[model samples]
Target: SAVISQKPSRDICQRGTSLTIQCQVDSQVTMMFWYRQQPGQSLTLIATANQGSEATYESGFVIDKFPISRPNLTFSTLTVSNMSPEDSSIYLCSVLFSGGGFFGPGTRLTVL
Candidate 1:
């Protein structure tokens, strides 16, 4: 399996601001996705980063609020836009590599 890493391991942002998280995979992978786990809640899929195409967002998530960019096979970014206190959560990137699934160290965001 490939090792995944995320930048800005954690952050504290003010409401109405935005933050972008970078996800890097040690090796090329075909599938990449973003997820968020709110306090005391399970992980929720935000979107699927598709190479050469727009990301596919899951229900309750809109591209305008959670934009994603996949420039290549091994790198992608997810931006939380116009954040609010309710948006504060732990964000994660996941990839399927070598028949195994791996998750990047999450980025914890706190919106004031």
Candidate 2:
């Protein structure tokens, strides 16, 4: 199993502000995944960041909106650009598991 950690358990930010969340892993991994859980919605994949390469974002997400960086094999970051009320969601860090994937506690953001 992979252990993951994220910063800022929760936050209240003004609209139009940006927040960068960090993710760290206990061990190096080939692919690190970012996800979003918006209240009643299911987990949606934001992007896949592999070491030494650019991050591949999923549909409905773009690099400008959710810029990602994987400086190393065990660390990655996601920034929500010009956040709005709709951007208020639980951001999560995930890694592939034997059966599926595991996620971190998550960062709860509220845009006021």
Candidate 3:
């Protein structure tokens, strides 16, 4: 099993600003993923961050908007740039663990 931790568990940001969230795992895992959940909505995968390669973003997401970095096996970060009210959501970091998936507590962002 694995445990995930995220920084800035919740924050309020201004429009046009940016916020960087950090994710750390207790143990090395083969797959780490980022997700976003809008108000009253389901989780949407943002990207898959590999240990030594570029992050693979989902169809509606672009690297420039949501840049990710996975420097090693148990650490990663996601930066949300040029924030807006629409960008306000709960961002989560997940890791594959023992054939199941475990997620961080999540970062709740409220853009003004």
Instruction: List the candidate numbers ranked by TM-score, top first.
Output: 3, 1, 2
Among all windows of 10 consecutive residues in model 2, the one with the lowest summed lDDT is: 96-105
Which sections of candidate 3 miss by over 4 Å?
none
Question: What is the alpha-carbon lDDT for the whole of candidate 2?
Answer: 0.92
| lDDT preference between candidates 1 and 2, better one | 1
All candidates: TM-score: 0.96, 0.96, 0.97
lDDT of 2 by residue, 1-112 (tens): 8888999888999999999999999988889999999989998999999999999989999999999999998999999989999999999999996778878889999998
lDDT to native, each model: 0.93, 0.92, 0.95
Candidate 1, 3-112: lDDT as tens digits: 89999899999998999999999988767999999999999999999888999999999999999999999999999999999999999999976687689999999999
- In candidate 1, stretches whose alpha carbon ends up further than 4 angstroms from where it belongs are none
lDDT of 3 by residue, 4-110 (tens): 89999999999999999999999987679999999999999999999999999999999999999999999999999999999999999999865788899999999
TM-score of 3: 0.97
Give the C-alpha lDDT of model 3: 0.95
lDDT of 2 at 30: 89
- What are the C-alpha RMSDs, in order, of all predicted structures? 1.0, 0.9, 0.7
